[model samples]
Every structure is written in structure tokens, then in C-alpha cells.
Target: MKINAFADVSLRALLVLSSAPAGELLTTQNIADAVGTPYHHVSKAIVRLRELGLIDVERGRKGGSRLSQAGHKATVGQLLRELDTRSDPAECHSSHGDCPLIIECGLRGALARAREAFYRELDGVVVSSLPSFRQMAPVFQTIGLRPGM
Candidate 1:
């Protein structure tokens, strides 16, 4: 199942924040650049993540975000569930009209089950453990942070 762009950006931003050293925070723009996403997209992702209590944001000229303690323990599945707001993977209704097969579509249930299965598979994976610091050297470097410095 394909995730939405917001979910993708949220995951990327979280991964970037997880790679930072303790006490090191990254601004929305920095995260956007690191993830190769537009600043506005990353900004929205940051706001959602902050609302979910996944990242802590400090407000000020020097303000930035860092992975929160909850973020470290959050599972990929949990984060995705929070980020992906769609109840149905396939939109049955559109400006034109409802899908012709909306009444008897078996694809909907199948897709929903598949999406749940996908989330189950990732439930064991902690967000912070997605990549090791050594493995994230390049990602950190992309954000102008030297790993292990």
C-alpha cells in the first residue's frame, strides 16, 4: 500500500531528527533540505509530529526540534497510523460521483487488511532504531551535522 506524501515527509523528518546527537536540534528548513523535500511540506510534517508528541519543539531564534523520549519508543506502525488519516485506502467518492463498485467492492476490505498487515509487520520496529548512527552518517552529514562529533 502506498502511503500519503504527508506520511512520507513525517517519517523522513523523524528519521533525520533521530539521527541528531543528544541536545542537537534541527530546524524545519534544515530537515526539509536534508530530506530533499520542500520547506512547506516539512513544516507541516513537523507540526503534525509535534502534535503527536513525537518531537519536542523549542520556540525562539535558536529554536529547533529534537526527537522526544516518546518518539524514541514509538513504533513505525504507531506513527504511520497517526500520520495517515485516511480511513479508507481507496476513495470511493469523488467530485464526479461515488465509485460504481462502492456497494460491492471486495477490493476495499482486501486493501484495508493489507494495510493493517503492513503496519503489523512494522510494529516491532522502533522509530529510533530504524538506522544506526553509523549508518545514518550520510543523512546527518546532509543536514550539516557530523556524526559522532
Candidate 2:
């Protein structure tokens, strides 16, 4: 299954915020730079996260974005579900009745079960359990977050 870039960015954003100091507000540009995504895309993802009550945005010079609550209680599954995006690996046309062999296709069932297992694994992971950004400094640098930014 291929998850969208939005899911990647959302996860990164949450993980970054989880490592940041409590109540520290990070700008959209900051997040964009950290996630190696466009500013507008990060902004849109932030809006979605806000709508889902996963984040709170503060507007102004001293304002930015922060997690609505601690990361300990936030599961990766919650973020993925709130994104409402799909990561389906197979193009089973059973929904549109386009595939004549869908009824007998073992591939479809296997893919579906695999997808469920993928989400189940994700569900078991909590944001707080992830290594801190400081610990992943090399990764952040590789993703374009300049040192000390």
C-alpha cells in the first residue's frame, strides 16, 4: 500500500511537534522545511489536522502551531484515519463491478488482509514512542531541516 505524501507530512509534523518544547509554536514554513514539502501543502495539512482536533493554530507574530495534547495519547492510527486518505495496494474493481473475476480473486482478499494488518501495526504505535527529533537529527538534516533551524 502506498500512503500519500500528506500522510507522511502529517506524521512528520506531529512527530516534530512532539519533540519541540511544550507550547512552542512552529510556523508553517518551519514545518515545510522540516518535512521537505511545500509551504502550501504543509499549511493545508495543518488545516486538516486542526479540523481533526489534533492540532491548534495560533495566528500572529508570536503565534504558530502546536499539538492539541501530548503525543503520548496520540496514536499513529488516529492521525491516519483523520487524514481520511487511502493506501490501497490493489485496484480491486469489485466496487465498480469492473473486474469479472473479483468474486474468485484470492489476490483481492490477500491484499485486503495485508492492508488491515498494516493499519493494525500502525495502530499499535504511539507518537510519543518515536525517537525524539534531536535523536533523529541526521534524518531531519537529510530531509532539509538545516542545522539549528
Candidate 3:
């Protein structure tokens, strides 16, 4: 149940948006630089998050991104579901018939349970509960935000 690098950046992008003062729209490059993630990955996450209705993006000279209302109240688990972008267990075990143990293995079931438990644990956490970025003073400056934003 490991989060992929894309998902990791997505979560951080949300956290960066969540850190903003209300109504602040942030550029994806700012988030990428602030989180130390590649711009490509961060841009992809931003687009997906926008499509999922968790964030909003507007184009134009003064345009940028901002967390939507749902984003503000998003649970870690919910965001993970949107960003996970992977299957549980393995494709070989589920439908490919690529594994000899597919017929009798309990591994898939166990993995499913473990993944559910992991999400259950994460569900209790709200996005706002993530640590404040205020601790990273240098990043705030680079992101064009004031400290404690």
C-alpha cells in the first residue's frame, strides 16, 4: 500500500493549496518548487485534482489554482483514492491468469484487507491535519507566500 511518486506529489500539491490564505490561487510551478517535485508530475496532479473537483484552475495572466470547497474538507483517504492510480494485489493474480497460484492463493484477499485497513487508518485524517508549511520558511519565500500562510 505504498503511495506512488505521482500520488505523493499530488498530496503535497493539495497541502500547498491548503496552506494558502483563503481565496489564494497558486501557480503549479510554485507548488512544484515548494514541494521539490518535478513540474511535470505536479502539473499532472493539478490537472487531475481539478478534474476531480478538488481544486480549481483558471487560465490567463492572473490565473492560477486554488482548493475547492470539497478540497478544503478532503480526507487523506479520499485524496489517496483519487491519486492512488494503482490496483490492489497485482493484475497477474486478479485476471491475467499469469500466476499459477491465482486459483488457490489467499494473498490477494489478504492484500485487499491490508489495503482497506490502511485506507481506514488514513480516512480519519483530514487534509488540514497535515503539518503546517510555516515551518519551512525558505519554501514560503520561493512560493511567493508569507510565512504562516
Candidate with top lDDT is 1
lDDT of each: 0.86, 0.72, 0.80
Per residue, candidate 2 scores C-alpha lDDT tens digits across 1-149 of: 56778888888887776665556688888777776789998988888878877778899898888878644468887677666454444665446666676577888778878777777788879975685656757645654543322
Worst 10 residues of 3 by lDDT: 88-97
Residue pairs with backbone overlap in model 1: none
Off by over 4 Å in 3: 91-97
Locate the minimum summed-lDDT window of 10 residues in model 1.
140-149
Pairs that collide in candidate 2 are: none
Off by over 4 Å in 2: 70-72, 87-89, 94-97, 136-149
| Residue-level lDDT for 90 in candidate 2 | 64
* Candidate 3 per-residue C-alpha lDDT over 23-135 given as tens digits, one digit per residue, 9 for 90 to 100: 87788888899899889989999999998898989998888999898888888888787677566556543454578867867887887788778888999898866856555
User: After aligning candidate 1 to the native by TM-score, how far in Å is the CA of 121 from where it should be?
Assistant: 1.1
TM-score of each: 0.91, 0.76, 0.89
Question: Candidate 1 has what TM-score?
Answer: 0.91
Per-prediction backbone clash count: 0, 0, 0
For candidate 2, give the lDDT of residue 138: 66
Judge candidate 2 against the unseen true structure and give its global Cα lDDT, from 0 to 1. 0.72
Order of candidate numbers by lDDT, starting with the best = 1, 3, 2
